[model samples]
Target: MGNVIKMDVYRMLRSRSTYYILIGLSFFLVFLINNSHESLLDSQKGLPVPKAIVGIGFDGNLLSDQMSLLQFFKVFARSQSFILILAIFSVLFINHEEASGFTKNIAGQVQKRGWLLFSKFICQGLFIVLAFLVGLVTVLAAGEMSYDEIVLGNIGQLLKEVGLQFIFHLAFAGILLLIITLIRQAIVSLLVSVLLCFGAFAFLYHAIDRWIQQGLGIPDFTMNNYTITGIISQVSIDSAKGQLIRAVIVALIYGMLTVGLSVTIKNRRDL
Candidate 1:
């Protein structure tokens, strides 16, 4: 398992796409920081009413507040949608290997299919950690440079928020990995995973949520369970503890189920 993980990490680091993504994210942070300031100050120079409306609508809290780490980390949460980076990396790491016949070659040598797949999961987790580190450093450095004095919020709460978001990414990657492994096709799997994560799931979840809300007069069910939008919202810090707990439980369940499915398919299928 260690050997498998090492090889995967080596390959991932060598891939041009990985560097491209990191470079792209760096530039994205620059853009986000440059334009993230509040327009309320600008309103003082012009029409206050219109600027206030614009400021309210602008989703640039990470740049505007500049103090809280949660706000800083919200850049990826805001811009990456629910699964953009995770989907791309999982597809490249898992589906691309299958498409190129690398997975089959490795599977022939590995004794346990589950262990092999779990190693891939570990590799995915490593990538997530690397991404989180990059985002954290970028935000903190940018905050220090942009704000006069960084006013941090609750440290414990910030850690919890970041940890939950990391878990969400891992869970989402597991789901994508299962789909790619089952389909065993690169382009098709990539498109399907992206659409499912980026839009399809959200759309279906929202429809169900709205129906439940209308019929049952429920206020918080959708916001608390498997709802990508709710999880990514900047205001999630203010959500009830129960809601966050439910979201984490749902995410873990989804991740475990998908991993089990992948192992089952690997064991039963001829691949």
Candidate 2:
């Protein structure tokens, strides 16, 4: 297991594409964080902090009562967060070697296919964490500069909320990476992952199931008077715990199954 993980890390770092992907993601995230504002932080004169932030729409409606670091993190995470970049990262995780035919050579050298698959998935997760931490630090820095202060009434609470959002979002990203491992192509996988992510948020059950409940799965936080919507749309995180649990479970299943299937197929192939 250690060898597998080490090999994955080594291979990824040795590859130019991997470094390029991380660098590109960093730049893309910084762009999102920077452009998410109506004007640069340096341009703000003396307007109310909430109003100044709300005007940018990077976080949420500052005029509302549900404003806080937790809510702000959730909103900012979706709008300007690098979850998309992370997801794209995962989808492209294995492509560099595959494109260069390194994966095929390794498959020929290895008798244990499971180790190869495990290493790839583990590597995917490692890269995800690496890339995410970079974005997290960037966001933290940007948050410091953007906000007048970051008072932590309960430091534990802030970490808990931020941590859960990070987990949920990361798991979502991993799912796409696993999907890519199955597809073994970069562009197709990336587009599919992005489209699914964007479409999931825009999609609602209004036109389908009329019996949707607030806590069925995700929390909805929208102010619209819609008769029904997923809990995710409501903005309350009553279901986040459950969502996190389920998302992790499903992502793991997808990751393992996809890796397993890919190995089986590759092993059976003539080349």
Candidate 3:
């Protein structure tokens, strides 16, 4: 399993597409941060209303240094709804290998199919950590230059944020991996994963919000847990414990169900 994981990481780093996708995402995020900088700077010019980052509706207040980190995160979180960066990377990084027949050749040498897949996912974690940390540093350095003194979260909270987001990406990527592994094609898995990651989540966000306010008398979708990153960033520890539990249960069930289907299909497919 360790060797499999190492090999996947090496291959991932070597892939030109992987590097291209990472470069594109880095630029996309930097664009967002730059746009936010301009908007906020303009709004500070004798205006009362705060300029919103990607329009998450921040009232025009200069973020304290610590809260500036929060603002930076909020900007990224708003764009995350599209699953834009993640979808691109996971598709080309994971599914493209299978579609191009690299996975089958690698599988010939692996001891266990599931372990091999898990190793690939682990490689993804490494890939994302590098990308995310670079992005975070970019935002933090730029934000500090523009704003007042602000200490980002403690190391533990920072790691929690990264780890949780990483898990979310892994879970979503696992879906794409499983789909492509079973179907042996790239297009369908790519489309389905993106649509589910973005489109379905959009629909569910609305539906869940309406249901919660109407049924439970709680008007806070910000405090819900149907989405992993959202649940962590938006919800408080005391207010959303139930949603947290529900999120875990749902994530596990969906992950297991998809993985089971993939394994079943792989066993019967005679590939």
Candidate 4:
């Protein structure tokens, strides 16, 4: 497993796409910071600041003041752009081994082929952590340079949000990994992942919820409440403790189920 992980790390580092994605993220942060600064300036001048420019908080409130570093982090966390980028990256990275027939060689040597897939997941987690830290540092430096006052917010809350977001992202990545494992086609997996990130299947979930409410007469029941995408859409810094707990539980369940299914398929099927 250690050797497999090391090889994955080496491959990931050598890939030019990895650096390109991170560089793109840095540019995105710069754009957001510049827009935020402009919005603040316009507000000070008594000009009408666009609602879109003001942005919405996790609590659904319009941000009237200059955004703090923590607030910027929250914006990045909630943005579909980050998830979309990860989806594309996962498709490319996971498909590389299969496309090159590298997996066949490794699978024959390993007693437990499932560990090979698990090792890739470990590397996925590491990449996510690196991306999160890179985003944090970018926001911190850029926000400080752009704003007159940079509020750091509560340290505990920041850490909590980061941890929860990481789990949510990892679970989402697991779903993409499963899709890639099953389909083994990069283009199809990429399309499905993009749709998932954009909530393209939301109508299906909503229709099911409606049917359950009408047939079973369960008025308070909602499938979104238990879904990763739904939970992430609603999670905010001000979310109640109970809500956070539920989000964590849902993330864990989805992550474990997807990874387990992928490993089972890997072990039973010839790679």
Candidate 5:
């Protein structure tokens, strides 16, 4: 397993897309902060601020002028842009082996073929963490340079939020891995992942929730509450203990189930 992981890391380092994604994310963060700074200047000069800047908050409320480091982190973390970037990266990264005809050679050499899939999943998780840190540092540096008084509020709370976001994101990557493994097509996987990031299946989830509620004779049984995306949307820095616990549970369940199914398929099927 360790050897497999090392090889995966080597491939990741050799790939240009890996660095491209991270570089793009940093530029995106800089753009966001620049826009926010311009909006702040406009508001101070008694001019109208754009609706886009006004709606930057997670709750669709006006962004506070005194944006704390925590608030900036939350805004970036909650946005689908981060997940979308990681999804595309994972799809391309996982598909590269099959596309380059490297999978056949690697599968024959490994004692347990399933370890290859597992190693890829583990490496994806590591990349997700690295991306998270990159975004965090970008936001901190950009915020300091843009704003006059950005507070460093509660380091513990900030770390907790970062940890929760990482788990949720890793689980999301697992879902994409399962899709890419089953479909074996990068384009199709990318389309599905983009749709998921944009909440394109929201209606489907709502319909399922209604059906389950009617079947169980329950007034408020929502399937979304137990879904990974739903859990992510509901969680926040000020979320209650119960909500946080539910988020962790849902993330773990989805992550484990998807990885397990993908590994089983890989082991039982011809490579």
Candidate 6:
């Protein structure tokens, strides 16, 4: 597994397409952060920034009307675009390997299919974290360039937010791995992963919440609460203990189930 992870990481770093996407995502996230900074400053000029950031940390000093570091971080974290980027990263990572028949070659050298899945998960998870760091730096640079104040708000809270993001992205990688492992086609797998992630997940959340909870009269049963977005969406320093626990549970459940199923399919299917 160690050797497998190292090789995958090496291949990922070597891919030109990886760098291209990194450059494009960094620029786009920076633009988004800058644009949000202006709008937030305008609308929240005299308001108290919500103490509990919805997905990260909120601006504690909204009265000053400047974009603080935490608020800027929140801008990037709370956007669904971040989730889309993770899905794209995972899909492309695996899809490219499949298209190149690299995995088949690896299977010939390994007996345990789980080794391949685990290595890909770790490698792609690392890519997600690095991509997020790049976005974070870009946002900070853009904020400072635009004359916004950079407040390194509670370090503990900032670290917690980053940790939650890491878990979410890792689970997203698991989902993509399952899909690409089953589909084994580059364009189709890419399209399916992106659409299922950004579009289908949200739609399923709504349908279940509205139909199952309200129409079926199932008290306190919300499918959205278990969804990938729903789980990650509840992360905040001030969120209830129960909510945070639920988020962790949902993330683990999704990650394990997807990866486990993928491994089973890989072991049984003819490569």
Instruction: Assess each prediction's global lDDT (C-alpha) against the native.
Output: 0.66, 0.53, 0.59, 0.77, 0.79, 0.70
Candidate 5 lDDT: 0.79
What tens-digit string does per-residue lDDT give for candidate 6 at 51-147? 3322222233332345555555555665555666767777777767667888788887776866887888887788777777887777666666664
Predictions ranked by lDDT, top down? Answer: 5, 4, 6, 1, 3, 2
lDDT of 6 at 249: 78
Tens-digit lDDT string for candidate 2 (1-271): 5766788888777877667877776565555544433343323543443322322234334212222455444544545234555556666666766788767777756776556656766766666567656655555555454444433335566577556554445445445545665677788887777655444434453433333334454344332222111112233343456654554455455445556666666556554
In candidate 1, which residue ranges exceed 4 Å CA deviation?
38-65, 78-82, 143-156, 210-220, 234-238
Output the better candidate (2/5) by lDDT. Answer: 5
Candidate maximizing TM-score:
5
| Model 5 error, position 158 (Å) | 1.2
Alpha-carbon RMSD to native, per candidate: 4.4, 6.9, 4.7, 3.3, 3.2, 4.3
123-234 per-residue lDDT for model 1 (tens digits): 7887777777777677666756655555566878778767777887788778877988788777888888766644445666778888889988886667425644345543
Predicted structure 6: lDDT: 0.70
Compared with the true structure, what per-residue lDDT tens digits does model 4 show for residues 150-242? 677777888877888889889887887798889989999999888887778879999999999999999987887887767766776578988
Q: List the residue pairs that clash in candidate 5.
A: none
| Candidates by TM-score, descending order | 5, 4, 6, 1, 3, 2
TM-score of model 3 (CA atoms):
0.71
lDDT of 3 by residue, 49-72 (tens): 443344233223433334445445
After TM-score superposition, what is the CA distance of residue 67 in candidate 3 from its true location, in Å? 5.0
Model 3, residue 170: C-alpha shift (Å)? 2.6
> Which residue ranges in model 5 land beyond 4 Å of their true spot?
34-57, 144-146
Number of clashing residue pairs in every model? Answer: 0, 12, 2, 0, 0, 0
Q: Per-residue CA lDDT of candidate 5, range 150-263, in tens?
A: 777888988888888889888988898899899998999899988787777889988888887887788787876787766666677588888788878889998999999998
